[model samples]
Target: MTLVEGSGCFVVTDEGVRLMDLVGGIAVNALGHCHPEVVEAASAQMRRLLHTSNLYYTTPQVELAEALVASAFPGRVFWCNSGAEANEAAIKVARKWGRLHRRGAFTVVTLEGAFHGRTLATLAATGNAHYSDPFRPLPEGFRQVPRGDLAAVERALVDPDRPGVAVLAEPIQGESGVNPLGTEYLVGLRELCDRHRALLILDEVQTGMGRTGTMWAHQAAGIVPDLMTAAKGLGGGLPLGAVLVSKTADCLEPGDHGSTFGGNPVACAAGLAAISVITRDRLFNRAAIAGDQLKEGILGFRAMGLPVADVRGSGLLLGIGLSEPWARELAGVALQEGLLINPIGAATIRLAPPLVISDDEIELALEGLRSSLVRVMRDKGL
Candidate 1:
C-alpha cells in the first residue's frame, strides 16, 4: 500500500484508504505518526541547526543523551543512525572490553532466533542462516545458543576452546515472532554474564521506548545490562539509534568509533520530544493496560475457535499464533478489512501499535481482525 500520511493510530494511503496501523512502523512509532510535539521539535531544530560533525556539539544531542541516561541505567551514549549501527557499536564495545578485561575473549554468545540487525557484524551476531547465508564469510567471533536455555548459555560462555566475552540478546525477540525470553531467563543471563565476566547486551531496538510496558523491557527483568542498544522508537519516527554503555563496560577510547549523521540535531530533538511525551503522559503504563485489553480481545478469537492458537509477548509487542500456517493470508485479509498488521513467517501475526492507541481504537482493531480471521478461515475451507 502507498501510505501518504499518518496521524495517531491510523494512516492514509495515496488511494484514500485509511487503515488502523497496528504495526506502528514496525515498532518505531511509539507516539504514533506526526505527533505534534515531535513534529514541532524536529521542525524547530531543523530551522535552528540541521547538522554539525562530531567535532561540534548540539543541545538536542546532549539533551537526548542525558534523557536516555537518566531514564535507563547510568551510561555513556554513542549515537547512530539505525539499530544495526547501535548493535555494531555494542559489538565493538564488547570486543574492546574483552581485550582489556577478559584476556582477549572476543566471542559473543547470542540466542538462537534473535534478530540483532542487518549489518555484516550484527548479522554475524544474529547467527541466523536465512539472513547470513547468502553473505558468506560473515564476521566471526560469535556463537549461537538455544533461546531460554541457561545451561547451554553457560556451556558456551565457559567453553575453554573459545572464551565468550558477551551474551547478546533481545529482551523480546520481535522478528522471530515476538517471543519473550521471560524474566527468569533474563535474570539467568545476567547472572551468567556476571559469573563469566562477560558483558550482558540487551538489544531493545523493537522493545524499547515504552513498547513493552516499560522504557526498556529489561527493566522489568530487574537485571542491569552492561550495554544496551536502542533504535526502533528512539528517534520518534526519525532515524536515531544509540548504544548505552554502563560505566563498568565503558571501554571505548578516542577514535574507537564514530558516525557522521548519527545524532543529527533534528532527529535528537524529535527523540527528546518523543521521550518527554512518553514520560509525562506515562504511556508505558498505558501500553501495559492497552496491551492486556488487546491480548484479551485476541484471545477471545481463540475462545471462538477462529484459528488463533496463542497470543505471545507482553505489552504492545504481541504475536498472534495461528493453528494453521495462514498468517500471510490472514494479513492480506486484514488489509482488506482496513487494518495493518505484520505477519512473521507463516504462523504468527505481529502487532505493535502505537502507545497512544485508545480503547476505542483497540476495539476497532479487534473488530477488523476478527472479521479478517473469519474471512480467511472460510476462504481456506477450514
Candidate 2:
C-alpha cells in the first residue's frame, strides 16, 4: 500500500510493481497521480502559508470556495478534511434546521445501499448492518429506505411519528458498487423533499468533480439539492472536502461546527489546481466520451463468451459485473497481470479511472480485464 513514487496514470509500489492506476486512488486522483499543476500549486502554497485555521482569511480557501459555488452550486460552503466530515457538517445543519423549524423533528432518511462515510453519524446513516453492527448504540435520528423508492421514503418520513428533516443519498452508490439512480428517480426525490418541506442532500463524495460527466451528478437530473457534499477528486490526491449549502438549507450558525485543518491553504491550493485542470482541459467532456467508450468495450466482451454480466455507472465510474461471485478472484488475476481494480461486494469490479486516461490506456485496461476474466471463467468452469 506504500506507493513511494508515481507519475501520470501509473504508480510504483513499495515492492516496485508499477501498475496502471485504474482506481485513481479510489477516485481522489481525478487529475491523475502527481499531476504537475497540483504539485506546483501545493508546493507554492506550502511555501507561502501552511495552516491558518478558519480564524483568519486566506486566498486559497476563499478562492476554492468561490470556484466551487460559481461552477456548480450557488451557496455557502463549509470546508472539511474528507467525505466523512463533509457529510457530518451537512447532517448537523439538517438537524439544526429541523429542531428550529419542524417542531423538533430531527430524523434524516438515507438510501439502503448508499455508502455515506465511516464516521459514527454517517455510519448510522449508512443502511448496511455489517458496517454499523460492530459499533452499537450509534447516533440516533437516522433511518434507511430502499434506493429509488419514493413511496418507501414517504412512509419512512412519518412512520415513526416524526417529521423528516432531510433525505440524503448518493446519485450513484460507489462502495456498494456503481449503482446509479436514474435522472427520473433523482428528480422525484427532489420533488418529494420539497413536497414534504424536507431538505435533499446529495452525497457527491464519489461522483462529483466531473466523475459523472458533469460538474455535479445531481445536474443530470436537472434539479438542485438543498445541500450537497463533495470530496475524493476535489483534493487532487490530497485531503480536502466541501459541504455546499443552498440558501434554503444554510442553517448552520457560527461556532456550530469547525475543523482545525479543514480549510488548510495547501490543501485548498491543490484543490483549486485540480478544479482548474479539470475545467481548462475539458476533462468533464473527456470523462463522458471515454466512459462511454470503455463501457461499450467492456460490454463487447460478451461476444467472446466472457463473464461480464453487466456494466453500470455514469461517466468514468463503472462497475463490471459478473454473474457469479468471482469478482475478487478476477481482481487478483488482474493485479498479477499488472492492472489494478477494486472488487466490491460479491460480483462487482469497480473502475473509477482518472478523467485524463487516454484511449490507449483504456485499451490496456480492457485487455488486462479480458484476460483476467478468461482465466477466472475457465478455472471456475463457469
Candidate 3:
C-alpha cells in the first residue's frame, strides 16, 4: 500500500519516512503542496460549482481572469488547462495575427533549448529536436534557431519570404539547463522583431508568476511581447494555464478557440488564492533573496574545490553547471542524503524550490549538494 498523503515541503512516504521537497513538485507547488488556503479554496469551490461551460460565468473564473490580466504583459487573458494549452493558444494568436496583419506569413520562430510544451503544436514549437524527432511531420512554420544569437535571429527576420515569422522565446531556457538569454540579445531580438514586423511571443510558462524574482522574467529586458504563455505556478498546483494577447493580436473571434475545462471554477479559486498569497506575502522578493543565497553558496562550494563551472539564474530558478556529466549521479547522492532535487541534463542540476522555502531549507539543500558533490567526485575518480 503506497502512502499518498502529504503537504508543504515535507512529504511522508508509504513507510512513514518524512522527506524534504526541494523541487516543489517541479515548480508547480508554488505555495507548497496542498497549502491550506489553496486546498480550502478548491474544496469550497468544488462544493459550489465544478464546471460551468463557456456559456456562463462564475466568480472564481472571473476573479482569476482579472488577476491574470492585471499582472499580464500588457495584454488580455485566455484561460486553459495546462502549459501546453497556453502555448497552443499563443501560437494560434501569433499565426492569426500574422495572417491578418502580414497577409499570410505563418512561420513562428523559436530558439533552441526552449521547452514550450508537449502538445502537437507546442512540441513543434519547442526547439529541442530530441522531442520533435520522435514525431516527424510536425506542425508547419516553426523556425528553429540558436538561442541568444541576435545576428542569426536578424537573418531569419530579414528573410522577406518568411514574412509572417513570429519570434517565440523563453527569457531563460529553463528545461535546457537554465541557459539565460543575455539582456542585450533579448532587447536586440525585440528590436529585430519590431523592425521586421514580426510578433514577439514569450513562452513564460516556467519563468512567469514571480519565479525569476520579477513578476515576469522578460521584465528585466523592458520589452513587452505581443503574446505570452503562463501555467506552472499560475494556479499554484491547481492545473490552470493562460495565454495573454496584446491588443494588436486581439484578433481572436468567437469560436476561434474554446475549452470545456480550461478555467474550471475550482481551479480558478485555487489560482485566486495562490495569487493573493504570492502578491500579499511578497514571495517574489523571497525568491530573489533565496536565489542570491543559493548562488553564493554554490560559488563558495566551487571555491572549496568542487569543480563547479557556472551558477547562473535569477530568483529561485537556478541551475548549477558541473565540470563533468555527473548531474544524474549527483542527484542520486542528494536523494540518498534525504533531499529532493532533479538533474536538468548530463551536466546541469536545476533548483526551483518553493518560493516560501525557509532559509534553513535552502542551506540544508546546499549542504546536501556540497556533500553529494564530494561523494560523486570521489566515485567518478575526479
Candidate 4:
C-alpha cells in the first residue's frame, strides 16, 4: 500500500487519503518532505558530484564543517552516516581522550533510559535493557547510573581502579518517553566532569538542531558538552550525521577516523541547506512558539479530562503520557484519522510535528488526538 507516498507534511497512500506527518520521520525531516530548497540543492549537488573518498576533501564538506564550527560548536566536525555512527565516533574520541592521560580510563558513564544509537557500542551506551538484551554481553566499560544521581556519577568518575573517561547522556531521553534531566543535574554534571577531567558527551541526536526550541537542548541548561552527536534533522531527510567536538575534545587527528561516504556532496549540500533553512528562517524561534502553542493545547485537553496525564517538553518535541496504557491503541486511531503520530512506549505518546507546521496544522493534530482519545475510551468502556 506504500504506507506513505508523495511527501510534504501530508502524504498520500494507495488508499488515496492525505495524512499529516506529525512524527517527521522520528524528528529527521526538519524542512518537511520535498522541501524545494533542500531538494534543489541535493539534486544540483548530486548531478555535479555525488561522493568522494575522505582521502580527498570536498568543498561541500569543508563548507558544512566551517558553518558548524562557526556556529555555537566552533570546533571540529566529524562527518558520519547517521546518529549511530556519530555516537560511535564520539565514543572513540572519548576513549582516545582518556587514553591520553592514562590506562583503563575507558569507562563511560551513561544515564538510565537514555538512547544513543543502534550500533553495538551505542547500544551498550544506551541504558535501556530491552535494546541491549537482545545483544547481551555488549562491549565492556559502559556503566549505567541512575539519571540525576550525582553521587553515582561521582563514584563512577572517582573510582581508583579505573578513571571514567566520559559522561554520555541525552539532555532529554527522547526514546524513553521524553524524560528530561533536571537543569540542576546538568550544572552539577558539568562541574563534576570538570573536577574529574572526564569529557561530558551529550547524545543530542534526537534533541539537537533546534528540535528543542534552542539550537541545542543543552543550551537551555547553560552547559556545553565536549562532544555533541547531531543527526535526525541535520540532513533534512538525507543520511547525514556529525560529531561536534570542542577544541579540547578534538582528539581524532587526521587519518585517525574517516568515512567513505560520510561527507558525500549530495548529503553535505542537503545539510548546508538544512542549516541555512533553520538559521535564516529562524525555525528555532518558530519551534519555540509552536511548541508553546502545542503544549498549551495538550494541557487544555488534559484539563478537559481527556485522560492525558503529563504534557511536557520544550519546543516541538512534546511527550504526552496517558493515565492508562492506551497509547498503542490511540496511535492506530490517529493513523486512521489521517494524522500520523507515534507512541514512544506503552503509555507515552510522543508528538514531534515538523518545525514548519502551521497554526492550523497544530489545531488539526490536537483535534485528531481528541477524536482518537474518544474512540480509545469508547472501546475500553471508560
Could you give candidate 1's per-residue lDDT for residues 168-222 as a string of tens digits? 9999999999899999999999999999899999999999999899889999999
RMSD of each: 0.7, 1.1, 1.6, 1.3
lDDT against the true structure, per candidate, is 0.95, 0.90, 0.84, 0.86
Regions of candidate 1 where Cα sits further than 4 Å from its true position: none
Q: What are the per-residue Cα lDDT tens digits for candidate 4 across 191-229? A: 999999899998888887788888788898999888988
**Candidate 3 root-mean-square deviation in Å:** 1.6
Kindly list the per-residue Cα lDDT of model 2 for residues 226-340, writing each as its tens digit: 9999999988888998999999988788899999999789999999999999989889889999999999999999999988899999899999888889989988989888888
Which candidate number would show the highest lDDT if scored against the true structure? 1
**Which residue pairs in candidate 1 collide?**
none
Better of 1 and 3 by lDDT: 1
**Order of candidates by TM-score, top first?**
1, 2, 4, 3
lDDT score of residue 53 within candidate 1 = 89
- Mind sharing the TM-score for model 2? 0.98
Q: Candidate 1: global Cα-lDDT?
A: 0.95
> In model 2, which runs have C-alpha deviations exceeding 4 angstroms?
none
Better of 1 and 4 by lDDT: 1
Clashes of each: 0, 0, 1, 0
Clashes of 4: 0
Q: Higher-TM-score candidate among 1 and 2?
A: 1
